[model samples]
Target chain A: MAVGIKDLAREAGLSVATVSKALNEYADVSEETRQRVREIARLLNYQPNVTARGLQSRRTNMVGLVIPTMEPHLSDDPYFLDLLAGIADEAAEHEFALLLTRCAPGPKERTCYQKIVRGRRVDGLIVVRTRSQDQRVAYLLEEGFPFVTFGRTDQGLDFPFVDVDGTQGVYDATRYLIGLGHRRIGFIAAPEGLMFGFHRQEGFRKAMEEAGLAMEPGLLARGDLTLQSGDVAMGQLLDRDPPPTAVVACNDLMALGAMRAARKRGLWVGRDLAVVGFDDTHVAAHSRPSLTTVSQPIYDIGILLCRMLLQTLQGKPLEVRQILLRPALVIRESSGGTIS
Target chain B: MAVGIKDLAREAGLSVATVSKALNEYADVSEETRQRVREIARLLNYQPNVTARGLQSRRTNMVGLVIPTMEPHLSDDPYFLDLLAGIADEAAEHEFALLLTRCAPGPKERTCYQKIVRGRRVDGLIVVRTRSQDQRVAYLLEEGFPFVTFGRTDQGLDFPFVDVDGTQGVYDATRYLIGLGHRRIGFIAAPEGLMFGFHRQEGFRKAMEEAGLAMEPGLLARGDLTLQSGDVAMGQLLDRDPPPTAVVACNDLMALGAMRAARKRGLWVGRDLAVVGFDDTHVAAHSRPSLTTVSQPIYDIGILLCRMLLQTLQGKPLEVRQILLRPALVIRESSGGTIS
Candidate 1:
């Protein structure tokens, strides 16, 4: 059996009520008595019940992360893994534990949030994959709960967030393709509702307009950010009256899928067609012919988000409530570019 | 302000004590009163404090997973990510939250375990990366805590665990290499203390002894399961008087590292120096000269471990407490083998 406060009281020759007050560091308790009680408790190896103490202090020293597993292939993407590693490492450094809750994207997601928030299971939360008009962000704001997001939501609420400049990243990739003398370029965009989708699409359009290239409706295809979706989208684009000489995908997986589609159609990636991708995941560097991608420091973003959330929890005024990191375009064989 | 039990009591026209009794479903409360209190709570959207409830019930409904971040490059490996996804998905199915705590291996690791276990912060735990005589495992066993390990310990404890047959996996790879007309085979083993290290090394030795092949001590090198370590180990092996033509790495990252080392020496991986890796991770299939590896369903093992732990927590007898999964060898170009 584990030692308890009652045992500490008996060992210290004090009343149970007196020992409790001393252990809890109540102002009514004498400082010398409190110290003596704590010493005896430590020697007895008494572990205070965390839940009971949390009731009194109203602090759990834990942060919650709710992952929406609506996409079946969510785990296959290493982005979340990198983000989780960063958060976990930083949380450990601060002596805080991270509580993870997984739920589907609809009503269940709200219930998952409520359980953690209403129950006060965690002191703060770290939100990811924020969409335009994200209900999760709105709800947290309404409740005045502590949270920091990894992406921006268009709910017009002032909240702390860490995000990559997706428009800049996609714009750079598009300009790089145009610089390679590829006028007819196709785009594989992410599905609707994601904020990055809006930013990245704007970047592509800005780049194309700057080059005075006519927008082709047939050249734009939306993908669910999966390899299969990218392959299907690329195939549709290839079937158009005049196929594009180059393509840019919103993510590395889709870009690899596009490469696979090109290969099936008897086209060599670097020679016959050029491809670019986002999120320079591990597979991007190792894939055959290698993928050129926009690199976002996802792991570091997680660390930063956790730090911000911790600050918010402590009621510290944030020096900067929002951080938008610049994304760099990494040139590789897939982009048909010489590494300068 | 969030609705509390006091609010529910006021709205329901009952005393706080009676409202609490009804909400708690105590036998002393009348059935009608209980129904009335619940209806009022639902109407007011009252969420009970989870910590207080946990203290009363002695159940947190949360499972802890303590990841050892001693290895700096842990996030770079997707194995943990896959495992976490499986566990998180399964945990969500059971309405249990996963609490992640990261700590460097050694005294700090034991402290992490103690905080969660002694504090009763979780209902159960899922231990990973078991060592030959893991102190965590021993401590958990001594405390009679509910836990299921991803790997086995050699402490002779009758505990629940799910492990891949590392010996069989290595034996199969070694035998396959021997069958390929390669007499000199190099082994890149994992560092000492890991339980899998012992089993895998045994498998390599058993296979060599069965084939009447002389084992060269200089051909065997240990790596810390990182890409850089594998590169250094492979470089050392290649400098030997008669370096092995075929190499098998304990993991895909190390195998890729070995391939890089071999390429630096002007040797084609498939044509000149054959390589085999374990844990057919995402990078293994996309890598140039695509890796031939031993495939263990790491994600599925995580799911199974979680299920077993849930059963243990429920005090249900596990149908099969100790599960040893077989690892299959996947043939690819890296092993100089045609896929059959």
Candidate 2:
């Protein structure tokens, strides 16, 4: 029942195009006519047809956030949720809505990207949970579709990506445990297929090699970076003959699991087992023996990723392709302190 | 480069229309032509233009989920996350993408709805957290928009919805506490604005009334439904002249908070403050003392809501407008004794 330009023009005895131009603040419309058109449109509650406007301008002002299907680990991972809050908050601020699509990581994902691109459903995509030599990245590039990555890829082919300093985050966490006079340091690695997971393992090995410590293949247990998997990995680690006293999990959930494993064995967390986790999520602080971990500003990354995608969709040339946020180690009782 | 229909048709020595008809499985195309088109399409990696097909048929194959934006109590509600996971999982199965939008509950929410509707971004909407006299529902009805609600509203408009049986959940939890020989009962309420929160309180009242127990206003405390808020509510309840032996939290997080409060006061939970919670989320099991709570099939609700919307989009009569999924109570040590 809202007023259309035709109705407004007929009422005012003006042309429909003139009515539209006047209300839309075109210079061709005189001040008197513009005011008259506005008054009429206001009375009629004439909401503009965004679809028609979008068709003409070729801009939807909508950015799509395509998170790889919440898989075995990512779905349970509160990390993505925290990050989503940040991205959504920023998108709301910029008057942009995130068309969220949770697609499976492999070949099945192409359907969503195809629909999004051809239907003009979204202006750009925010790619997340990057895999080694990710097909999505390559697909976007080949299709000339605008997108930004949440993590860096192995090829390092320049694309707009906002990622954590994964290798450095591991380096700092591992180096801290090493500096605490611990030589028999065991590492909990992330799943093999993940890009961040690979980077973290590399960071851990690089630190050990730099310190002239032999990387013990036996000491490394690959966890899916889930709390449950962490528990399983910890059980494996603790069962080793007079197991390594200290362990560094690539993520906080794994660290918590390790803590649980130690407790089950009737061992004090800080005294018998020194454990550290990466990505100091909320659970890290509330943990019984306050987890010693690496803190990454995840919320900030989400906001930056959204801003970066907007820039790309707006056809702005990004001077920098990869922006890595540094993570700092937070020392707590989990790294062998008075368990107060 | 991936091939188009024109390329496929040219390579196969067929007309573009014949190739299209063959790929579309139209009866007009000969079997030989269809086989030839398929081979060329597969060999050349000619991804189908789903959007173009959808446009011809006027179907976007996308649904939107609009949840209440950051409410103080339920803003970070873990329950919503579980429900979303279910919806996302089901939507993926049916070849649908979800466009997620968040808006604070107010008149400003209309803008978000308008964007989705007029922009033709989504085929239908999945609404969670409906309030009494919801403006969104009214708007949808006025415009003849297809939608499904996750929670029922006070308006009693029989719109398509999938909801956990809140009354049954609360009644069962309350009856379980009563069976433990605890006459005095306290209900920790979430923000009253939530329809489910109000229903939870109603169930608690019904259980008490059925037992012919006189209601005490002193026993009722409002919790924002977070663990911290639950702790605060428990403290307030304890401060009352005569403390209730058993407390029933609207959700598990609040129960966890109450548990922590009991621990801080040097009171054994199972011994002193018998507690029960609702919506048995993953955090419910992970909590210390493993809370006894109501198990609402959140994933099932998500799937049903999506399926309901799918049916509506496919021109199916929404024969089932309101769906109430049964909720079962999970008895754990937090509720005091093992109830058989």
Highest TM-score: give the candidate number: 1
Error at A67, model 1, angstroms = 0.7
Q: Listing every candidate in turn, what is its Cα RMSD in Å to the true structure after a full C-alpha superposition?
A: 2.7, 3.8
Model 1 Cα lDDT, one tens digit per residue, B9-65: 888889989999998778998999999999998777678888888888999888889
lDDT of each: 0.86, 0.78
Q: Individual DockQ of the candidates?
A: 0.65, 0.26
Which 10-residue window in model 2 chain A sums to the lowest lDDT? A69-78
In candidate 1, what are the lDDT values of residues A1-340, reduced to their tens digit? 7777778888889998999999777898889999999989777767777888888889898999988656533545678888887888788788788998777678777877887888798999999888997999998988888999988988788999999999999999999999989988999999888898878888999999999997799999988888888999999889987899999998998898898888889988888889999999988987878899999998888789999988877889899999999999999999893221
The estimated TM-scores of all candidates read 0.94, 0.88
Residue A87 error, candidate 1, Å: 1.4
Q: What residue runs in model 1 are displaced by over 4 Å at the alpha carbon? A: A15-39, A337-340, B15-35, B337-340
lDDT of 2 by residue, B89-108 (tens): 77877878777666888777
Output the number of the lDDT-best candidate: 1
Clash total of candidate 2: 0
Candidate 2 docking category?
A: acceptable
